[model samples]
Target: MAKIKYSPEEKKTLKSMFWNSGLVFAGFNMVKMEGNAFALTMSPALEELYPDVEERKKALVRHNGFFNTHAVMFSLIAGITYALEKEKQTKGSVDDDTIENIKAALMGPTAGIGDAFFFNCLRIIAAGVGIGLCSTGNVLGVLLFILLYGMTQIAARWYLLRMGYSFGTSFIDTVFESGLMAALTKSAAIVGLTMVGAMVAGMVNVNLAWTIKVGKTSVVVLDVINSIMPGILSIALVFGLVALIKKGVKPVKLVFGILFITIVLAFFGIF
Candidate 1:
């Protein structure tokens, strides 16, 4: 069977749609999550492919179901979905259930991998570099970060969209067989953890100024703690916060709690 080819203009249009409308309507509901934005992103392609009002409506409705994933990584899924829809339109071989099933199966893994790699690793690395530069009072640091991160995302969207369309279902099998996805996920996670650790070590400060007088010798509390284990207090604080989070403490409450503690400690000369 001859494969359908999208015009350059159509490809450009789809890319624009995915980039612009990806997260515009993101929300949580009982019916669907991110469904409205997903449908909106694909509306142009659906309209172009299915000229019949009923057919277009069906396509739109088919996509307007529970859909949640990393907002950017979903572009790859969108591309594959568009290709599958086109195939269904032209060949009538693929079914709606297959399409929905593929989306449901892929969204979770894609989101997990995407969040670990892009959000935790790439974003943190970019922010670290940008912030370091910004501390020097250079405005270019902010621009550099925006440009670097934005361009990478845009390029990934464009490339993944094209790759998904070109390979369709075969791409999934190819990725699994090659083991590239797993390797990437693992490597990104390691790097992300290392970077996060570095950030915590540099950013978190816990010092004790109190001293104990023993036999006319003043021993600094912070110095003793440092001698025993540097950054132990900081590490403990981080773990404490993590435990609180795991215990269902709301983030806003945690923020205010930290603020209150800091204020009280500073006022009492205990920090």
Candidate 2:
């Protein structure tokens, strides 16, 4: 048989697919760190009791299978969506299940790797180095920041593209069926917990209340709720919002509510 070759139309579809895949990969990398950390922080028992290396080692193929699945899935979805939106193709036939499956299958794994590699490793290292070079706010620091951050982003793009184009198309099902998914999910849970702990300790803010004294007897009492765990209240707030979201509340409405609450608290000097 003659060597099979992708036609121009297929090539175009593939390119578009990879582009969207790359965008999801990049966007998640930028935002998933905090959430991942929050998850890790809140669940130490799960992390500690995570399965051993031998099991994971056996499931190595499954572990790295997303690269292939994501590449092909995204490429095809991107192509289909483009056809639907741009070409005004048969919109009715586009099933919700297909879209949801694409999203659900990819998002969790994407968030996990994005957090570990991009958020935890690259961003943390770049920021740490950047801060260190603050005193030397010379051209060197600026150059270093630009170079490191740019390189990290570039590398992410390259790797994700490779995964999408090569592995995504070839080994999608075998990867999932290998029982590696459970292990990866567990690893993600562990990492997420650790990330969350770091966030609670670093990102969340809770401070004691200060009040003016009456007469000479200065009445001072600690802000008990805030004092116990400074970030707990904020974490609880997020959890409440998430619960609302899970119950079908719109994210836009939730955003507005969070903003309103934040502004009110700030106005009263509480937050």
Candidate 3:
């Protein structure tokens, strides 16, 4: 990574990207959450890639799709996308689907790592120390939280963003040079799907309280299900929603369906 050198123009573009990426929460929406910030962060690179007016607009629209991830991972993926877009313009090895698929694949795993480290570990430690200080009437508590948690995340985002660009470019170039582009794409999709399944198992919960009366005993349905295979129901629910979404179902309807089903299940003493 240290061997990678950037021209002055490249340095300026990356500097602008690092600053723009800090506005990760800007123009957030259900359809394209974080996309506006992603486009903003990628703008400097995109401008350098696509000099023509119409082509630039098309490239911007292509990137402004639904993208969601932890803010730290968001910068990383943005950096990778910049590299992919550059590849698309220069070598013509990476196409639209390849870029989009790679983005989708990287987001989940990177997000899980980022959240576990930053949100779960760092945030708790920072808050605990900050709370301890504030309780002792030290104004430094609030500032400490900002310094430990906030500033740390900002710095991490910047580092990961640059690393993503440098590493992604080198990695993509290697794959192309070795004629393993398709293999790598397939591998990435496999890993992405595996991560999604793992997330569903860890995060999704089906709180089953139903019991069946056997001849002389009561057997808990959830326990029986778990015995057969743990979290199968959660996996099913997640994949089912994914299938529906692929079939063009809107997210709002799915949310309402989940709410309705949960309410009905709760009323019947199952959730």
The full ranking of all candidates by lDDT, starting with the best, is: 3, 1, 2
Candidate 1 per-residue lDDT, tens place, 143-240, comes to 88987777787778777776666677455346556877555345545554565566469767887667788998988889889899999999998789
lDDT of each: 0.73, 0.45, 0.85
On lDDT, the candidate that comes out on top is: 3
Tell me, by TM-score, which candidate is best: 3
What C-alpha lDDT, on a 0 to 100 scale, does residue 107 get in candidate 3? 75
**Residue 202, candidate 2: how far off, in angstroms?**
4.7
lDDT of each residue in 1-271, candidate 2, tens digit only: 1222555654554444444444443423222322222222212212222255553343232222212223223333333223222211122432333323343344445555656766678767887777788776655666677678666565555444434434433333343567564454455456645554554566555443544478986543334455675567667766786699789887668768767977787687554
Off by over 4 Å in 1: 1-5, 24-31, 169-271
- Model 3 alpha-carbon miss at residue 161, Å: 0.8
User: With candidate 3 superimposed using the best TM-score fit, by how many Å does residue 8's alpha carbon deviate from the native?
Assistant: 1.4
RMSD of each: 12.2, 14.4, 4.1
Worst 10 residues of 2 by lDDT: 38-47
- Candidate 3, residues 1-271: lDDT per residue as tens digits? 5347888887888889999988889778755678788888889998999999899998887787767789988888888888899899998988887887788788787888989999999999999999999999999999999999999999998888888889888988788889999998787777766765665677679889898889989999999998999888887887898899889998779888998999999899876
